[model samples]
Target: MDDEYAKLIRRMNPPRVVIDNDASADATVIQVDSVNKPGILLEVVQVLTDMNLTVRKAYISSDGGWFMDVFNVVDQNGNKIRDKEVIDYIQTRLENGANYAPSLQETVDALPTEEHTSIELTGTDRPGLLSEVCAVLAALQCNVVNAEIWTHNTRAAAVVYVTDDSTGYAITDPNRLSTIRELLCNVLKRNNDVRMPKTTVSSPGVTNRGRRLHQIMLADRDYERVERSGMGRVDDKSSRPHVSMVNIERDYTVITMRSKDRPKLLFDIVCTLTDMGYVVFHGMVSSGRTEAHQEFYIRHIDGRPIRSDAERDRLIQCLEAAIERRASEGLELELCTEDRVGLLSDITRVFRENSLCIRRAEISTIGGKAK
Candidate 1:
């Protein structure tokens, strides 16, 4: 039986060692002897399974005996064991013994939230720049999710991930957004306008003085009338109020201004005119500023030309207020073509006299005869 056991152990390679000397007369002696040959106690389990021997109730002794899969055998009580049952036993033991790996679901569920928003800011890079930005965000109650920042020499860019609070305090308001942009511009200007100290030395006979100067151009008027004169014709009868069409017998006016002044001017002028009870039928501002200028072409709902001096004065005042507001904000303001009489001729004359180049021009009027 000892020789048979030796042959069996040589064939089977179990992960652990086990020996069964059931009710043998020399059981203790045989167990002691079996422990002497470690190689015989460590054969492959696959070979044992292929051999068809009932490896019943195998267990490793504390003294380094041969290994066994308990489910590959029948117990002394005649109960059959399954491979799955053995696997479950092994898994539970490993988990309890601190050698088990986490499942995929467990890993993923432990990750952070996926939703986020990004804010990008770029300007002159300086020490404490990031700290200042973070301070502002904290004041606004924004929770930073993730961020990546990089700076090279003197330039920097940052992508900030943020989450807005329920009170909407985390996100910047429209006015605050504009203010932030202006603040960034100011910061850049500070870096760009740094002045260097000047040095001077005495010469044997000649003296030199370092001179610095700055100049800015100022126009005599904030606004200039663009004459759209001699382009088309207008009839006298068609110029009357309630007339459906203003006969294009002569010329008409189309007003324009600097591009930056377009919006505030348009809104203020439209509001003022509407408040003064002048019905504006159709109006459109040419696509923003082209060639450093923008045009607001408007037509009165009434076909009659603006006749009274009082009405004209009121219109001029509205235009002036719009221009002045924009100018006070450091914007350039100008008026082009607001007169209907000989407008085309006057515009041509002004452009010629000033030597101003005309890149592109458009003309339209309400109740004017079709070209």
Candidate 2:
């Protein structure tokens, strides 16, 4: 019987949802593990919001195509939701499918007013950067009207236009404005700027810095040559990835990724390929002052160049998504205060009541203070 179930699970790959009662706490805990896809987190949160349940603490992590997320949730009045039927309903909804479209009634009833506001954010890029910003805005009930993002010199800058979803008004509340500024500053400043790490060059030819300079020169020369040959378009922005095939006595495709210099970028790209079941044969990685470029000669593990147009397009899409996710995954929030028994849980309960979800947290105490 166990073996049969195991085989069934392998074929289905279905999401697993578990709701566990926390006797020591006022919030019920829910855990979900599933094959990760875009918008999965959003769907879960939307369902909870629609049910009028408040999310107090959440931990979200995705490795390759698998994700695990845990949420602490409570009723709108900050009471534990212990009713068995309700619990079963919630679990069923989460496991049923991702096509559940939430109603707009909650947004309409949230805080209706009319205001338009603009905010500018600049910081080092990381995975999930846009998602984090958008999540913050969503938590605050701010609706994005328009936004633009650009990356250059290892920095990301965004200009956002938003309006209050409830009231359709600009964010004029001083307290809300202060909260927005503080939260965004935390997200932007907590991580180091995305730049190449220091390294030693034992190569007989040149030092690391000298090699980087040469790579930049080579990149510039190649750009000019491409323009002269009329094979590629020139743009005013920093470089993006260019993927193509090799036709001359080689059975591999080449992927050229050029972006603002970032740490562990190659690791992220490699992980994406591994997830897609591809194998790398030969590769070259180089860095410029504020940019990095990588070229990989690769083929499917079954030893075939990506041939189908659909598969090639998916490869490019997944690579871009992986890079973007890595660039934005540095979002975090920090707290510091005096410590006491049950203080941490008490704080989390408050966040839950206020409808603020904590995706992840690190806590420690020093000098009689909790941080």
Candidate 3:
């Protein structure tokens, strides 16, 4: 009954967003007022990120079942937002926060009704692994539609969307899919012992492909440190995340985190916590040019603080893994060209032959152009 009442209240008082360009001389200021709810903060931030806006500064306050946030945001060039169309879109998206604006991810993930076959794979990180997988897919008449790959901590995870080369749609043949799985499994198993490679074909749009990558790496235990010696080893301690938790007033667990700031850092932390079934009741975030700091007063859904040291340690490990998995490393590279059936295969093969390792990559093709 109480939950229903909360929903009624939320509907009665929809979010209100006020965009004021004159509020700040350097950046546009956006203020949002709404009924407080779990994950509301994240939803607001996600909107700004989808529009590719950089948040220069923010003031967040949600208390007594009310949420009021003000953000100073700018365009990619760090200039104030004055374009009327973009301003209107931002206001519309923010006012209807529950229905989020579609990001590039939605396009990559394709349709939610199984327009493509989604593949999830994780295994030991090594050079030419991506090439090998691409080669095998090309051989089996699978067209790579869109894919996202991330490598860290001697582990790799990839979520790939593919369709039948002949039909340009999801592959439904059980026999052919079985063959594809068997061959890719063989390729992934090669030179992998730390953790056996997992390859599973799931329906498209079952989960957000990006967040699924985070979950995949976390499940593979990439947060736990290992020896750094091989070619893909990361030795940067400065980018490492610091996470600690303490009890406050014997009522809530106060989690404080500090690390080098990057885009989507807040979303990553909040997503991980929500996935672990914790709710952030109160929090603060401050992100500058180089570093980011966040503090959260959280509790389990059952309304209890952390029960034991083991739980605290495990939560810390998961949060740390979340930060490192997305760390920016390696040489920046770009490839923009026409999209084709065997293009990914050929490109990855050349990368392998040249001994170049791809630490992270975002693959997409639109309007006959692959990038």
Best by lDDT: 3
| Candidate achieving higher lDDT, 2 or 3 | 3
State in Å the error of residue 337, model 3.
0.9
Question: What's the ranking of the predictions by lDDT, best on top?
Answer: 3, 2, 1
* Between candidates 1 and 2, the lDDT winner: 2
RMSD of each: 40.5, 19.4, 2.7
Worst 10 residues of 3 by lDDT: 103-112
Q: For residues 183-278, write the lDDT of model 1, one tens digit per residue.
A: 534443433423211111111111000000000000111122223232222323331111012312322223433333222233334343443434
Give the TM-scores of the predictions, in the order they appear: 0.21, 0.31, 0.89
- Global lDDT of each model? 0.33, 0.54, 0.81
Candidate 2 C-alpha lDDT tens digits along 1-371: 96676557545887899898863376788888886654455456555654667555555555345767776676767778878867877777688653332433332112212344666666544445555666677777765543344433234455454566777557777787778777776666644333322111111221111112223322222212112122122433344544444422447777777666544355456556765677665555555546666667777877788887878777776666445433432235567777544454455556655545433233444445666
Q: Kindly report which residue pairs in candidate 3 clash with one another.
A: none
Q: Candidate 2's C-alpha lDDT? A: 0.54
Q: RMSD in Å for candidate 3, one decimal?
A: 2.7
After aligning candidate 1 to the native by TM-score, how far in Å is the CA of 16 from where it should be? 41
Tell me model 3's lDDT, rounded to 2 decimals: 0.81
